[model samples]
Target chain A: MAADKVFKNRIRRKLIQIAAFGFTNCHAGNFITGKLYNGKFKEFCTPGLNCYSCPAATVSCPIGSLLAVTGRADLKVSFYVWGFLLAIGAVLGRAVCGFLCPFGLIQDLLGAIPVHKFRLPKILTYVKYAVLALMVIIIPTVLILATGRTAPLYCKYICPAGMLEGAIPLLLTHESLRDSASVLFWVKLAILLAVIAGSVFVRRFFCKIGCPLGAIYGLLNKVSLYHLTVDRDKCIDCGKCAGCCPMDVDPVKAPRSAECIRCGACKAVCPKGAITIGFGSGRKAAKREGLVDMNVYSRK
Target chain B: MNKRKVIGIVILIAGIALIAAGVFRGELDVILRKAAVVCMECIGLG
Candidate 1:
């Protein structure tokens, strides 16, 4: 059964990677826009984390949109942008990272290049919160106040997403873009390379350590109305769940651990039908796991 | 489908719908034009 789960995960990972590539590379199709739309600019925005500045992006990045909205002097709200993000995040969670984020998919592919991997110290996880507070929130807000126009600080200065989605594609097509490279771009590129290299040793080093989006999604792990639970009595304590967890969460203690990406690794590894996912009462859930005796439930 | 799967399908469908609406409403085209203008202005390409 564990083997079957592993096999399924492998298949799912491949499918997700392919979908991400198709979504990311959809920019390749936008060149037709030049002829179809008669626009002086060759590119249009594709929505998500993709930079519209990238020669390849058929879509725009959400972070960019948020910045653009905040940057605007007009106080009017953008229902479309906010609605789009909520809908995507609520429906998909960080499934975007697992299934459709182009940059994330690239990182996964690069990590697969076969090299020594690294184990992360649990403490470094706090860095993502700081990143979220500073880059996505404080910096953009400050820029909006100062310039009346805000750039995506994370995307421009720190996001490997931009480097992969925008910088790489544009550079390949526009030679001048390469000559204009700033120290900032190279620094981000270095970070991207380091993360890519680190993924070889660490599973989802970026998501685990740095992705503000993932940090946002992780906040909803328990309350997203879907979560994992352990039937402790049924749990043989075989530790198979931890063995299977790519992020190294101990399921018994932290089934709904924010660190858990909800990849279903622990559930698949539980030999005794110990772990189940649902919205349920914790006591009843504990009973199902045999943590509480059936006799105990009956008395109530 | 499971919750995760349901969410996945919904996002894919909604994304397609939003994109289509933007095209049909002509709003997406307008936004694109605006974005292109801004991008060009930023880079001084036009």
Candidate 2:
């Protein structure tokens, strides 16, 4: 039974990685020939933070699309982009962070490297929302409204994903791009290096602390159809769920916390089989009962 | 269903409708044009 479980986990990881790469690889530009695929699929937005500027990217980043439309001189609201994000968030919440985002996949791999892992302070989790509000939304809107110039402030100044997936590949391939690289490029490179290093010691550092997309999705976790539910009756309160969580979410206490990526790591590690992922009001029912209905005694 | 589930369904329906309308209206052309170019600003070159 244990061997079967281990095999299933390995398969799950492989499938998730494949899906992550598949979304990014639809265009599949030729790296050797320095040709990026310019296909029709670029019209749509990918669910995760795959850089549109990346040679292999078939779709635009949703966050980038949001900023692009918001910062346009025309300044029309991107209902399509907003709607797309909302629908996905409502459906899956931050599951995309765990299973779809190429950058998240990279961070997960980096976290596998032998190192002393540590949990970040809970306060730091709120930083992504500030980034979402200030960098991704407010700043770009202000810049466009003030100067009538389109400025993707987050993509330009932050977004180490863009630097890693887009700039690095293009710069290495195209000499002109390399020659034109400036202080901003170097700054982005530094940030990218820091994020990469941080991920090794702190699993999903960017997703936990800085990803505006994650923040947007996190907001919908409470209402999302797919979410984690803890069966308090079965839980031993041994803290196994917390111990197994890579994102430092206490699934037993707050199964629907915004920080949770719905990665199912806790579900896999639960000795008491207390955690489950599903669609419904199971979590709300649990919450209403004040965590395991103490009124009823367990037969165990 | 709960209020949250009802609201989620409404939002999902509305979102799908908006996206479909946008597609029919040729807003995707705008997205395509923006995406066709290598966004220098996105890569921090500009």
TM-score of model 2 relative to the true fold?
0.91
DockQ of each: 0.11, 0.67
Q: Model 1 compared with the native: what TM-score?
A: 0.73
Residue A195: error of model 2 in Å? 0.4
Top candidate when judged by TM-score against the true structure = 2
- A9-101: candidate 2 lDDT, tens digit per residue: 647965987787786766565555455667888889988888888888888888878777776667455777888988898888888888888
Residue A29: error of model 2 in Å?
4.4
Per-model interface RMSD values are 6.7, 1.3
- Give the local distance difference test score of model 1: 0.59
lDDT of 1 at A143: 71
**Model 1 misplaced regions, further than 4 Å:** A29-49, A75-83, A277-300, B1-46
On lDDT, the candidate that comes out on top is 2
